[model samples]
Target: MTLSPSETARYRRHLTLPELGPAGQERLKCARVLVVGSGGLGSPASLYLAAAGIGTLGIVDGDRVEPSNLHRQVLFETVDIGRLKAEAARERLLAINPEITVVAHAFTLRASNARELIERYDIVLDGTDRLSTRYLVNDACVLLRKPLITAAIHRFEGQAMSYVPGRGPCYRCLFPQAVEAVGESCADAGVLGVLPGVLGLIQATEAIKLATGIGEPLIGRLLTYDALSLRFAELPVSRRRECPVCAEHPRITALEDTAEACAADAPLSVRRLSATALRRLLVEARRSGPGLVLIDVREPWEFDAGHLEGARNIPLGELRGRLDDLAGEGPPIFVCRSGRRSLTACAIALQAGMAAPAHLEGGLLEWVAAIDPRLRLVAG
Candidate 1:
């Protein structure tokens, strides 16, 4: 394909590099890379790849842009909120470089369609937020024999690695066990605005380097970055002989739905207590001067209703950020309408290294049914 005058000018910087001369540039132009998740990491990685003239770019994201995303998702603005991320990304990328092709899939990457969708691209980039999606993306990439450049971000830290087919180590090799339930994600933890940008840029460099066959990639090395300490470390990763996915006696012949499995594998933070147990605790709280601190992890409106007499209100979304504000604890018990939000609260409190934080057996619903049936719980 012949480059137009504008494309020639746009990629002049890339043309100046010895490894990425006209031939390498052409290879990039001919590359087909599928990027999963058009969030933080995906935004920068896809933008750079498109600007670099990656011939065919496929962006898959099932989310819409939000006002909060503007801080780190550099591709979008306040005006782009409520728009499909993939569609918005495609428009911005094409406007930046009309020479390249950008395909957008504004749908979730689920088990039913992952395999077929992955097979269409030469390389895969995992920019997803959850563990389930990461496993799904990894498995799909391996099955399709596509190179995957994966990265994940947390509060002040993030990690990145590259997985090539029949190469050193895959994601499963490192994280063999199902990950433990996380207390808070980026949404709850409050990530540094520039952290994902730096990590995403690294991801983009890795993808471009892999596509152009330039530098030695991080195939068997895991790069960990700590923004707080301003430190970077690269740890070597080795393929596990006992890995279920890529082992000598591989158990997984085909892709499996890991979403539910991952959820099951993770240990729940708050264990279910019987109604009898809560009654005993309530008696204990009545006897003690400062009874157990019953915390409602639901929204504000839910707390407006009569709670366990003197319960505190702190929504689960803001729990991690407000941990320090909490008083010296008695046996802290968390509650929501159902048990789900309390479980998340338990996880976050535990991760924050809180002392003796517990959850209402089945949250406010259980509390209402067991202690006081007349109390009405409302949603905010």
Candidate 2:
């Protein structure tokens, strides 16, 4: 297809680029790219691709725009909060490039539907934060022979890579095992807002370059960014012949949740102790022999307010680092406000092979309700 009369103005900058003249511009117009996650990376990637006149832009996101997203999710506004991210991104993107077709899927990408959705696109852009989703996207793209431009952001750091069909190493080849959940999400650890924007733009650049075959792709290379130092590093990657999906041996023939598989490998640290047994232990700790070390694994902010009188304080995120402090050869009764953190801490302690520590069956809330109904706990 020839450039439209209006296209000359819309993509004049692209036409001037030696690598992306009229011919390359036409290829972009004929290309279809599916971008996963309409947050941060998705927002910028979708906007730039649409602006560049990509023929069709497909967006898949299950989350909604939140007030917190306004900082970096450039495609959304305060008014768009609560609206599905995919729908909101489509509306904003079309407004930028009405010439392109913008299709929005307000649903999560799961194993069952991944193949069908990925098969429809020429390339897939992975902007998801979750590892499971990333593996799903990579596997589906490989099975369908679609190139994948992947990016991930954590705190002030970010990584980007490109996966070309039968050429470069897939994500699994680089990260053979799922990493333990370190509890440092953008929400918990906080982000600079501009980090995702930078990473997303880079992801978009990879997509554009790959589509036009302009520059050497990031295939088999991992680019690490340090927003704090304003420096970037590129690491070499090699394809694994033993990779379950991409390897020659190919142990994994069908689709599986890579992220979940990783998570399952190092499952949550907390396990349940029978309520009856816990109640009996609580009596034992209060009355006689070996005193139970009641530990509160909540944030200090939560601990200062009120906690069990004799409880030790160690936030769950930092628990793994402080395991040595708890290796006193006695059972510790871990407690948290709702039991979630405490349960998690107990799991960590147990995994460290600490003699199965106990959780205050119902946590601090239950401890107050049952053990000391009249205790004045500090309010958060």
Candidate 3:
């Protein structure tokens, strides 16, 4: 991982630093990073990562540049509008640093190829706009145990976070469900244009920190920026014990084709109900059943085995369609095996404009332990 003469001169500024001297420069030369999407956020992120001398930089984008993209996507010029984004970004990044190897993955990241694509790299920088693709990258990284630096933009504001395998929370731990275009798209909402540049820079910084093993990465904290107010905020996050993909008994053990991401990304919002309190609510609801509904979001067999008395079955996958059934039925309470799927259900309900939706905290396992152990239900 020794640096050549050209690399030495190229990264002269980095080499002069105390912490990131020759050793850090060499680590950057040895690092392999995949930058997913070369659009708004990916644009500045890829540029800096290349400028910083990431040894093998890969760009994954399946989009064609357009005239509108020129204003924000710094990787493309007017002449490159018709070109593929991955190829275009590869050329731009390489032109910036020919000393580094650039790999172009000119295809969409899908369930079929996510693992293989992500497995090839030491770290992943996800600056994708599509919510589904974002989740796909997150799950694949968590499964592969690779470090992922992810960011998102909405209007004049942006956010960034990092996920290091077996160390901190995954994106799903922060946002456990894929919400549809509930007012999330930049095309529809309009972006400040320069907003993503800030977040993308943050993504690049985190990747370099992770690669060079230097500055503390945003592993368990979410970094947010507000353009109008010029404020940067950090929110501490913790891994959910019932997280669908990273938990003890993950309900979503496999990757499936998520629907086309027409929805915009939303903030994390879910209410939790303790087992002891829910039992009282169930008793109260039995007399006046219209104000509240208990939803069991699990497999039919799991529900049939044992669930809270008076709970209705509506598995998490089908929770979207069943949302309408509960219309005017009052704000519902969702339950699942280990509280994972139920949290997803709560998020879905909130996205659908329903009243505040809540999940049984810790799921039925908590109910069994805290209230009724004789219920004969086991944690899956």
Cα lDDT, all candidates: 0.77, 0.77, 0.83
Estimate the TM-score for candidate 2: 0.69
Model 3 lDDT, full chain set: 0.83
Stretches of model 3 off by over 4 angstroms after superposition: 268-349, 355-380
TM-score per candidate, in order?
Answer: 0.68, 0.69, 0.73
Quick one: how many clashes does candidate 2 have?
Answer: 2
**Top lDDT hit:** 3
How many steric overlaps are in each model, in order?
0, 2, 4
Worst 10 residues of 1 by lDDT: 260-269
Ranking by lDDT: 3, 1, 2
**What is the C-alpha lDDT profile of model 3 across 1-380, one tens digit per residue?**
78888888889999999999999999998999999999998999999999999999999999999999988998899999899999989998999989889999999999998888888999999988888898888889888889999988877777889999999999989787776655435587677889889999989999999998997889888776778878775656679787889897888777767987632346433445778778888778778745468899998888888877778999877988878899868778899877767866777787787756777766788888899987756545
- Give RMSD (Å) of candidate 2 vs. truth: 15.1
Query: Distance from true position, residue 158, model 2, in Å?
Result: 0.4
